[model samples]
Target: MRKTHLLGYAGFSGIFIFAISILLLHGRQPEISIRYDAMSYYVYGQLGWLLWAGLLGLGLGSLALAAGLWRIQKGAYARVGILCAGIWGTGLLIAAIFPTDPKGSWDQPPSTRGMIHFSAAIFAFIAITLAALFIAHAFIKDGHWKPVQKWIVPVTALTAISFILIMISIVSIFVSHGAPLYFGLTERLFFFMSLCWIGIASVGLLRSER
Candidate 1:
């Protein structure tokens, strides 16, 4: 199969894995809100294989998408954008390998493994956000994907803003010794926007090749 098709499959499958995973877990975790408790499912769910498999698929699929982008596109923006996606994929892989302590276990003293998971989560968020921003810039400058660029710029901005709100909420929670407001909503917004961007870009590239 052509590389573009391969990447398209990967991109589509990555989204599928994430969607299916959440759907499967929805009934199992009645108390956990997907908006705020997605990481909990990945980190602490009893259905370990399901979560791990989903994350693995996401990691591998992201890496494949990055490779496809790098292979098809030229210029510094494309290079840097794809590099960010690659690193984000690597981070997700590592996070899957090092699952964090269970939900409500944060009060316990941090373990080395837990620290690794936390670091990986942070890295993944930063890298994915950067990837979106860089790709938006690339699309604008390249002009070949102008329609995508038009939509991407707004999506990237919203994702970044949501990410910042999440970070702020995290800090507020720690410093104030209380729950920060809208934590789950902001996190979901960030990931949803970023992932949507990835899906759209992948589809656009696939269509362009046809």
Candidate 2:
């Protein structure tokens, strides 16, 4: 019933939905290499609804968490961090609304919808990384979460760099006719790190209130 608890629940729900979506979709497309395929590709097949629900869950959960943070905290860092989280949530919704063009379609110039999806994906990556770093700094400045501050920097760096690599991969698609060899791996790494930071920061903030 408490606002902080709601944030924790949102964090957990986001993590759970995304994890389950990946688990269920992973083996469903054996031909698609998890190492090279984008998770968005799952939105094209028999169990596509799972990914849709998962993305919606992530978007709603992020907004809910941001709202909860806004209610419980006050400061520039907290405000900026929550605002970034909100942007990230909105990006997820945009991505869901505009799914990427199919695999073969990747070669051709992106359709209007596909370009929108790509733009949303880039926005989501940047927003979430900023959210993570800003939130981590806020917690550290609070003076009670030194432990969190310790690990957050490295995680934030990895997330940011991974995102950059992903962007490079996308650029490679336009330049040389294909994504980078490590595109999928870098993408997954970024997603997982960002999720870990969100979950940990949400729980950490909740516990700090207690």
The candidate scoring highest on lDDT is 2
lDDT of 1: 0.74
**Model 1: per-residue Cα lDDT at residue 165:** 82
The digit string of per-residue lDDT tens for model 1 on 154-199 reads: 8888878877887886777677664445566676677678678778
Task: Give stretches of model 1 more than 4 Å off.
Answer: 35-38, 141-149, 178-181
What would the per-residue lDDT of candidate 2 be over residues 1-210, giving only the tens digit for each residue?
677777768877987898788788876866656677788888888688888888888888888778877776688887898899899988988898888888656667888988998899889988998887777667666653555667777777777787788777767776777755666777888888878777766666566566
TM-score against truth, every candidate: 0.88, 0.90
Q: Highest TM-score among the candidates is held by which one?
A: 2
Scored by CA lDDT, what does every candidate get? 0.74, 0.78
Report residue 30 deviation for candidate 2 (angstroms): 1.8
RMSD of each: 2.2, 1.9
